[model samples]
Target: MTDIPPLPETLQFTADGLIPAIAQQFDTGEVLMMAWMNKNSLAETLATGRICYWSRSRRSLWRKGDTSGHIQKLIELRYDCDADSILVLVDQSGAACHEGTRSCFTRRLEIDGSISEAETAYPTKIDESARQ
Candidate 1:
């Protein structure tokens, strides 16, 4: 069996008591989504083994895949060097983006290194609608 490491002590949550959390697929190492989390949501997610996030717009705790059944199951959680962010390795089911994309990084960068944003759009034949 493997050990799931505990949340680190140095994570720097913001003034609003929130931290940036990035979810990545454990098997594919694909970035799933970026979300915020308060202490309560983080603790609850750890306790339940289900990914939870603080939705800034909704101003509430968001349990991943609660509505769409595209849940993210926690495998491990890690902190970056700055301690101001979190990386959550998860077993993702279905899609991660709210629009129903498998990953939040479906965009490609230009040869000049310009960044582009892309996400999935479910319920039809469409996969992505450009964010830029």
Candidate 2:
């Protein structure tokens, strides 16, 4: 069994009372997605062992995989040196993107500032059936 670390005290939230949280795959070290978390969501994430994010558009607590089944299980949580950002290590179950991709960062930028999509999409087909 491992000891649970205390939540950092110096977290610096943005003006809207949110902190940028980055979710990364624990085993593969792949960046999953970037989301915002308010104090309530952050505390809930720690307490529940599930990743919870504050949805700016919906203005509610968006528990990952709750709707789309792309859940992110919290493995570890870390804060940046400035305490303005958070890193969430997680065991991702399904595609982390709404576009049915493994990662939300599938787009790439070239030196000339051109964008390109990844050749291979993970989990194969894009599932848009979850959308209403």
Cα lDDT, all candidates: 0.82, 0.86
lDDT of 2: 0.86
- Give the alpha carbon lDDT tens digit for every residue of 23-48 in model 1: 98887777878999988788888888
How well does each candidate superpose onto the true structure, as a TM-score?
0.77, 0.83
Could you tell me the TM-score of candidate 1?
Answer: 0.77
Positional deviation of residue 43's Cα in model 1 after best superposition, in angstroms: 0.3
lDDT of 2 by residue, 1-132 (tens): 123345577999999999999999997788888999998888888988899999999999999999998888899999999999999999999888988988898887654799888743233344588444
RMSD of candidate 2 to true structure, Å: 9.5
